[model samples]
Target: MDALKEGWFSEINDLWPGIAVSLEVTKVLHREKSQFQDILVIDTKAHGKALVLDGIIQCTEHDEFSYQEMISFLPLCSHPNPKNVLIVGGGDGGVAREVVKHPDVEKVIQVEIDPAVMEVARTHLPFMAASLDDPKLTVNIGDGFEFMKKHRGEFDVIITDSSDPVGPAECLFQESYFALMKAALKPNGIICSQAGTAWANLDHVTKTLNHCRTVYPVTAYGIAAVPTYPTGQIGFVLGSLDPTTNFREPIKIFTEEELDKMKMKYYNDKIHRGAFTLPRFVEKALTSSHEIPQESRKEL
Candidate 1:
């Protein structure tokens, strides 16, 4: 891997107090050259900072609620009564924050490798940063994969919010990780992960989705439009223990009265269901179910 400093700081004119940031060109110089997928670490901010791989915006200044809320709540809301939740690779504590919102969630264990991310998020992004301090949350700074190995059949929901398939987070995009995650889930548990960009990373997204199908009986995919992400596109892969779970039905998840109480920024029954409505091209790509062998995926 190589590093090159870019004009990232200059791009963001409005710098905040105590905000420490770093941007470097990251490379994987093996058989396939994926130069755009560089690793970026922004720390020393009011909250803790983060490391983002590829061009995808793993976390941002504005609203992480939209991403974390949708990903965690999608399966959480569906669960009859979720007790414990395990978040893999979400060091920033965004997902943990939302998971605890459920009245029934007793404990939330978040395993993130980078401690810098937790610090930056807590210091800078207050809306989400404070999630790290939730009484029901426990922070674990280490490899999420290794944590999964130690705690198999532990959590009712496991949400993977790692960066795109590149740099340090590349391993999370593999089929083996999905299998490991399945083993880490309780019999009634479900898993949701940020796959990749639907536009720029169709192959990566499809590959993850296909792999999920091989592991979980119930698997489906969804998309979101996050401005900071590459081409303003984001996608998620969902897996469950049951073989036949459908996400399309029930446009209205809550009563009009309940909707008023929980008026969210980006997600609703309509938006949640619409997020799964993929484009024709994506539909076709998903039709041909096959893993993108590392050799062939690298060629493109």
Candidate 2:
């Protein structure tokens, strides 16, 4: 963990104006305005190399595994057989890195709009970008929505490793994106996406879950703790094509030897179940018998 002698990179979340997280910056590896947003790769004091997009911290070497492993494995393990997977907006390659670890997965198609993000990640974040060259992975540089529209009932599992609901990623959190993902999933397939934070954006979690229910009969929510993210936690929305799919339990169990072989750092069968246990307020908001009042509904 190398610390910078003088400079620092501060991530200020406009949505949550009260708090800001900063890392001691050692050196800037890359900085550029790509086709979408501002991309930056920096070496930090304690978290090692980190990726920042639009002045927000996306992932760091220290705790990125928690987010990558949880998001990728949660939906894949919940399905009976996840062979062909589609990842939307994981340009850094962390999600792809985790998706290829499942032995049952035969192919992975990653769609990212920005090629610059992948190029920077490959050079600065090798731990996550290492799997971009795997034979099982097929990288496509294009809009994820347009790509999914052409492929229907094709993917067994679809994971959206997108940034928060802002800038280029704003559309990714809308109902239309989930609708497209629903149409692209196999009959018994499952889809998962990074759905903001429960503590900071409960409205985001509630509305996203509500939108998902419109497309997929089986919909649930999960959370993971990451130090670099806002509120030190992130939430995921999961939807299943089959109404009876229980997301809390793993359909395909992994043995200890298999888990060790995968070298999973943060995700396991027990952790999968525990991730869905939301706080009282979040549970009430997401599963309320009555509609959320007009005053209670704040725009996400």
RMSD in Å for all candidates: 9.1, 4.2
- Can you write out model 1's per-residue Cα lDDT over 29-91, one digit (the tens) per residue? 112222323444454233234335343346654445678778877777656567889888776
Best by lDDT: 2
The models' CA-based lDDT, in order, is: 0.67, 0.88
Q: What stretches of model 1 exceed 4 Å from their correct place?
A: 1-56, 250-252, 255-263, 290-300
lDDT of 1: 0.67
What is the alpha-carbon lDDT for the whole of candidate 2?
0.88
Q: TM-score: which candidate is best? A: 2
What is candidate 1's TM-score against the reference?
Answer: 0.76
Clashing pairs in 2: none
Taking the candidates one at a time, how many backbone clashes does each contain? 13, 0
Give TM per candidate. 0.76, 0.94
Error of 1 at 157 (Å): 0.9
Q: What tens-digit string does per-residue lDDT give for candidate 2 at 1-300?
A: 122224988777676677778899888989899988999889888999999999889999999999999999999998888999999999999999999999999999999999999999988899999999999999999999999989999999999999988899999988898999989998988999999887888888888887877777678889999999989999999988876788888887788888899998888899998998888888888877325443432211
